[model samples]
Target: MLWFPTLSKSGFRSFIADNDEGSTGKWMVPIPVPDIGLIWEEIEDAAVEGRILAAKKSTHELVRIIGHNLACVYCSASDPDTVAETLRTLREIGVDGELKYKSDLATFDGREEYLYSSSEFETLLPRP
Candidate 1:
């Protein structure tokens, strides 16, 4: 059930297309990142703050990869050779768990907050 951060386009598409039912649901890929991995949450917060919600590309990719693999262990099925490269590509595109920012006030349309720098995420976020 451990899931990796990135996979190829074909890999991604194949993952989500899988169909099945059992102890593992169709999209039951548990995020393997540490500490509940605030990546997705942070991304949502970033989008809402900027008032420009981003399409859930990475999330969908994960669904796809898991679906295609038809197994919760999508990350395990990943080819280690390409894992690093794919992660690099994702990072470059701001799709790699990076709460990407854009400077377009027209899109901002009011809802905006100070950007969440890496150093500020833990502090800025309310403790549960």
Candidate 2:
């Protein structure tokens, strides 16, 4: 995997134009959106159907990712059990949400996968 500190459409074009498929099995372009978290009100006390809706609403982005890539987003109030339920529910509805302990990443397309980073010191660079 090639992690670019910054990328642009032209940069992506340059990447695709490169002739080094042997070096990089796949390329991943990360798009990080800030200040967005899935909040589920009364998810624990809700019924199965309610939890389904809660899970779907909370993890809707997992299914909507475009292209061959993954996404790492934050979900508020995501306990282990809740996260498990969300993953299960997402699978039931034909979506994929994975849980990496000491981690936080999810992939929609099957091409490239990125594990959630467990780093405290991180930076988000601009991309276009």
Clashing pairs in 1: 14-68, 15-64, 15-65, 15-67, 15-68, 16-64, 18-67
lDDT of model number 2: 0.27
How do the residues 53-75 of candidate 1 rate in per-residue lDDT, one tens digit apiece? 12132344555665432111111
Whole-model lDDT per candidate: 0.28, 0.27
In candidate 1, residue 40 scores what lDDT? 45
Off by over 4 Å in 2: 1-67, 72-74, 96-128
Return the lDDT, model 2, position 26.
16
Best by lDDT: 1
Residue by residue across 1-128, what tens digits does model 2's lDDT show?
22212221122211121222211111111322331221222222232334332211213344245422232222222334433443444333333222331222122223344333212111221112
